[model samples]
Target: MLPKLGTNETMPLQMTVGLTYDLKDDYKDAGLDPETIAELDSPATIDGLEAALRQMGFTVVRIGHIKNLTKRLSNGERWDLVFNICEGLHGVAREAQVPALLEAYQIPCTFSDAAGMALMLDKGLTKLVLQNHDISTAPFAVVRAQADIDGVSLPFPLFAKPLAEGTGKGISPLSRIETHQQLREVCTTLLQKFAQPVLVETYLAGREFTVGLLGTGDRTRVIGIMEIAITDTDGLYGYNNKTDWFDHIQYKLLTLETEPALFKSLCTLSVQAWQALNCRDGGRLDIRCDETGQPCLMEINPLAGLCPGFSDLVVLAEMAGMSYQALIENIVNETLHRYNLPQPRQRHEAA
Candidate 1:
């Protein structure tokens, strides 16, 4: 087991980290919808991550996506660890592609493993796991077709989205339905457009928040809780709001002084969900309150966006007075400690 680093302690090691990512620009001309590539990283994101890694004294290698990674691996290329942020473009197991490949080669990688990635990608499956563990989540059902919509016993005013999508790919003003007719219409459109099952859940009408976390298993800790206040006419943080967050959203960092009980509840629930899902390294968990003011787990983002100052996680870190470099260092430190690898020596005094 690796020893935890104290404030003045450090592990001296020189390592080469292979970075795996799917660039949004690479697929802009692939005849795909804009939402399809929204979760993919930008060139700026990759550049920022690479710079952070190099600053901490690690050799950084740009290994593109799974195709590029497969080619390199087949040719016997390897690294001390793979910093994977690949949101693949295929099926339910898309996000698992890179981690699964690395696992097969007995290589260590950052973030969750293949099983966790596959399970978390499917929103319906993730809710099942959460329910089984007695975790608080909204009542939901998966609709695979138009016929399945009739079988949904959930009450009206339901929120529906693609069963296995991220970055609010299938969410819109139409997602929040108040009638059976609207539900049917939205579900039909989503099923046909996304080619995936629709997850219709009892709509949580209260405040929305996302909790940032670091570490894994028993070592996992909550970094901060951020309340996502939607300022638009329609109160849904869909793709458009997320893409143009500057104008449509306000992110407030919660604290014990302002929201004592709610803040604790959100942190406790987020950590429980993260541990139950066996997520590694770091990520974020989205939570929303119901009509009765009870918080419910919305989803788990095990591989969250890392676009420096733009991503939610980065924003949360910044709000908490944690620098971007420190956020990256914390993630790297947690991974190294989990894997019993030599950790990086502290380079900067700021956090």
Candidate 2:
């Protein structure tokens, strides 16, 4: 039962949610094959969220790609909450821009606000913050230029990826380097190829896991832990492997294969990492077990993927015995609960 606030007072109503999604403005510059871009861009996934919100009795508003969101929000139309899915344009600041826009309007939105998104997007900054909190993350350094790799003390088999990138953009099989020469070559390649700062980290070889968290502060709950079982491939979960490198052996789901008790430990650590970062609403923590089986934090995804079947959170939730419907409903209810909104009256209660 929900705590009673005031019986006579009507619960605040939510209406007309605004959506923001990445439109991929850099199709030509990113060298994204035109066909791939077309496939990626057109499939607007607002339907599931829309149905959920509507079922909760809210009107859904399609705010298609508010480019200058600050100026637009300042125009004075009020919304109860901005259902922020704005992953932003295909740039480094894609995730950061949405909540910044909402903050201007003082409108509460779903997921982590802009500041958290900004902090987590930069891999270097996220690791530093984790280290300060006494979190066990792999040793890492940032290479802004190829020249910056010279002073790195973290030993190889190091993993290198974009410092500010998400969605596994520049990660490839060759990202793991075993020597100084390979590091230089990979760093140079990233500088020339991706045109972004490269994050080099001492790679920890062990089982990989992901944690899904919901709510903030004490209200947070660990939904489940999922392990990334390399059932078929010999390589890491890099771009090529994730995109198309799957073989028959690598096709197994890790959660299904991992011991139930061990996975629970992973779930515990993932939530710990979320708390360490002060993440709000819901998000995901990526973790890996070192050779000794101790969990090492990788990074947090405040805007954890929500693409129904394809998302990591969905997989984690399924493993934990919750259906997709139940997970989405929980997320919506939690967001509403954050503002102290009243829950919908059940038929029995209404009667």
Candidate 3:
């Protein structure tokens, strides 16, 4: 049995954690565009996570991806908990594939469940849920084809990107459409290139911010808010900007001490959105301001990347004075608390 919290009973075993992820190199020779595999983890990232989990006293097992996991399960293998970050390569429900499988096998995993993952991945679907919950989000439309672009009621000067992509895929300076012709061209290009519906929303002209959050439900709270300032006038913090952020972007950390009203509003809205979507553990919500500077939800990443120095979540955590190991530990502790499992001892404390 797993150890329980608040008890002095000696336990004979440590928790065994299974790690599931998709590596970028796994698909390099598949003749796919770079953006298609942008969300996959680097080998270094998996190695870093394994080292951290071991440092935290958990036996870590590396499970490659959905196919590997399926084979492992067929062999009658299981773990106390799974640290799943598998971003499946197909369908609108790709991100939910691993979690749903684990759910069927009666195994628990970190982060949001299947339903939440599916909803959050599709920008249009997520906005619909946010609208129902009265959360502030930009008006948007999903265009599946050229015919659908004509039906977009949203005004001109809109931004367009793939409906279910992350890591700024299908986004660029041209994403901001100033004319109907531009809109059609951009949407058509994205539709053909990604083979997915496109999401076109009103262009948020003010500043952009991404809030880092932790915990579950009512316990969810903002860890930090980092403003993404683009140095180039035409930059949109899209694929190019994100890929070369050091040269074209500036990250300004915000806090209640610096911007009290804005900070509180962002925190409140972020937590409300997190709960409304039933998201658990830790993640991030991207918010950008309208012309009037009111923050609006752009998208939610329940499975935020964990590539240590490269991921935005880790960068924000460092800005908030949290070490990489501490950020991982906090996520693990929150998951453990949610599952009613005893959290491991802190690395600095006596064993």
What does the lDDT read for residue 79 in candidate 3? 90
After superposition, candidate 2 runs with Cα above 4 Å error: 1-7, 12-14, 23-44, 68-75, 244-261, 345-351
The runs of at least 3 residues in candidate 3 whose Cα sits more than 4 Å from the true structure, single-residue gaps closed, are: 1-12, 348-351
lDDT of 3 at 174: 84
The per-model lDDT (C-alpha) reads: 0.90, 0.69, 0.89
TM of each candidate vs. truth: 0.95, 0.85, 0.95
TM accuracy, model 2: 0.85
Query: What TM-score does structure 1 among the candidates reach?
Result: 0.95
Candidate 1: lDDT over CA atoms? Answer: 0.90
Candidate 1: stretches off by over 4 Å: 1-13, 348-351
Question: Residue 114 lDDT in model 2?
Answer: 80
* Residue lDDT tens for model 3, 8-56: 6643357899999999887888887887788898998899889888888
